[model samples]
Target: MERKTNLIIAFLLLICFGLPRNLGAQKEDSIFYKSYTTTNMEPWKKTMEKMAEELEPGNYKQLFEVTLAWYGYIGYCLGNDKEREARQYLKSGWQFLEQLEEMPEAGAAPHALKSGFYGFEMALARYKAVIFGPKSLSALKEAAAIDSSNVHYLVEKGNQMYYTPSVFGGDKETALRHYEKAVKTMEAGGKYQQKHWFYLNTLVTLGHTFEAAGYLKQAREVYHKIQNLEPDFKWFNEEVWPDFVKKYGYE
Candidate 1:
């Protein structure tokens, strides 16, 4: 009876002490997948904050995930009309990106993200465009040059072309080509072995590009491909597709 009682005490102590370490491990390793699978950024905000808190100060992998999460969080805030909150995330995201400067392969993503943030700032204030627009383009160019095959870099480049004015050398057809290259990069490299938000978002962007350029049939076909790829994506199924069909007169 005494032996049984001691074993029970030991087991309880292990549970008390071991769980935190286990949970920390999960937070560290699983954050990428967790962030990827969760489309809604509100809840992911808390999850990412917790993940960041659990990260060791100089762990580049965790830092990269946290930075990426901040990017998404900032976008979410901006989309929800929470500009103040978005600015806060943007500040942190910049700091995190700065921390990654030593590793160019990893730093390329941060540069790409910074480029997007600069674009966002320009959108918020027209005066910023004169200062930030060139900076945004430069950053993305650097990112792409650093890693020509990176899908993220290609996607950002495509985005820059898509949004720039025609007088500034923006061409929708060129943007479509960049996006296609990004998709091809992923496919050729098997980068989508795991469910990746970037890969999925790239596909969505392709569909949007088609729609924006008045390629109704191409856009509809892309949407069908998206449905086949991710039948469980609720927003795509219930909202984006339905609304897109109506807006584009796809019937």
Candidate 2:
């Protein structure tokens, strides 16, 4: 009778603490995303590797998601002067991505990640730009064709257009259009879904474009929207928003 009473108390405690059945899995995903959004690349990379290890070999959905996170983390590293570490991530990333490609359900997801990886590789060695650049472009095109409505693929295409040199056909206007399309698609998925890392990234990138173009009003609005979605987002709450207000004045 005492053992039964104790078991009941323990179950009540779990419920009272709000520990949902999937709390462990949710915690892992949340930590990795937080690391990414805060620009903590090294920790994000490590978290992603840890996640990859936790997932079973045949679990393609988790594999695809973790691999995508790892790809983004590597790109962040490459851009932030962490080339030595990024190189190691890139090598491991490629191996994981290659495995992801074999999953029939992965569709164009693997291609999109591969395109980003190639672009980063080109950034590291300009001499290889001639080879890797076109490959990246071609891979993105294939990914888009296969999954035209995919927000992730659209965001990547937007990134490529935004960053490519104007002489080489970069078009900010076109990039903005792709980004807007992605935003609309994500929005249609409902507000709750927008809190995901991918959706937040699309909105953040759009906000940056607005700020860079000197559209302060638009940028401010985007930042406010982000705050509404995630009030405690440290980077925005502590850094980007404060700096923007400092530069432009909070009217």
Candidate 3:
């Protein structure tokens, strides 16, 4: 009887303590995705603060995931022209990346993140492009060379290809190919879970790329797919869909 009671206590203790380490990552991912879809940064800010307080030393994987979240959040701020807020986050965000770089487990993802950070810096000060532009491209290339199939690297490379001016070697066709390949890789790996923020983001980018390249039919299809997958995707349903409809008359 005593052995059975002790076993029950141990099982309950395991559930209380051990499970959170695994669940913590999922929880953060959920918060990040929700914030992204809803275009609300408040929850994201709270999660960042909480993670910063709770993260233990040498927990490289959690550090990496949190850093990626910071990268996304900083990008969101920059996209909205909140330069000051972006800069503030950039300060701590870079610290996190630097920590990842020093870890033995660090891989291509860190370089890819550096590429994104450089791009953000260039956006903040166009004059810095002369210095940061090549750095951004070089980091992305390094990341790709290290892990050619890395989804994050592929996405960043596609972004660069899509956004850079043609004079600087931007090719919409190349961008489309990269984005398509990234999406295919994710789908093939069964990584396109409905709650996966990055997968959804890649889809949205692909749709925008299609629209930019005048593939209105494909763009509409992609948007429709997103609608079916997540009808409450705030930015897509509220803003992207309306503008797309106004411009092209959705089928």
Candidate 4:
């Protein structure tokens, strides 16, 4: 019972981070992405291959492991097939989740993690709806039930709320709440795998959210903080400044 309880806690935690299907990524992937530059995904490809080689066969537990491995494979695929690869992994994620739910141990952390994994894929599916057809918001709703405080999925959900049309309940106020929750949770946790990106991404998202709400000074501060951290980061000098000028008419 104790072990089962622990598993439940862990699974819920994993789901919180895992189910956010946002294929959107962090500054670390940025390092890899910068290196690829339409020419060098081989490194990414090779890394996924190595990881896949070490994968264990699927079990009722740890199902998300397989899903995650496949996700790595799709994630490494370049350019034209990026979403295709991601979708393949998404399919794999759902298959694992099916098996996971059949057991009474659905309360386990692994099971919860599997939920997160599928939710993540679903979220990505929704975002890629332009290419992949219609989207589904069910993933976020389900994930929140599993673990309301899961920062990773919360962050993705937060972004969707901010960007999605009002017909979809994509309210800026709600999205900002999720984003703020994600930031606070990550900062407090401070030791997760995403610890490295959480701080930076949080600030960037905050800036973007505030900017959308027409808070220029706050947005500038966020960008300025990022610039202080990575003085040469291209997003600030290129994409962000141009957008600021075009939209806000900031000189």
lDDT of each: 0.75, 0.78, 0.88, 0.56
**Best-first order by lDDT:** 3, 2, 1, 4
lDDT per residue (tens digit) for residues 1-251 in model 2: 99999999999998877585257556656776677567565566667777877887688877876787777777677767889988887888888888888887878768878888898788788799889989989889889889977776778788888888899999877777788788988898742166567777778888877787677788888988998988777777777888888988886
Question: Lowest summed-lDDT stretch of 10 residues in model 1?
Answer: 28-37
User: Distance (Å) between predicted and true CA of 62, model 1?
Assistant: 1.7
**For residues 4-123, what per-residue lDDT tens digits would candidate 4 score against the true structure?**
999999999777877532232343354344433333546555543443455445443234434433443443442245776666656655665566557564433333344345444545
Per residue, candidate 3 scores C-alpha lDDT tens digits across 166-195 of: 998999889998899989898887544668
Top model number, TM-score: 3
C-alpha RMSD for every candidate:
5.0, 4.4, 1.4, 10.8
Ten-residue region with minimum lDDT total, candidate 3: 188-197
Clashing pairs in 1: none
State TM-scores per candidate.
0.79, 0.82, 0.95, 0.57
Instruction: lDDT winner between 1 and 3, please give it.
Output: 3
Candidate 2's displacement at residue 109, Å, is 2.0
Decoy 2 TM-score against native: 0.82
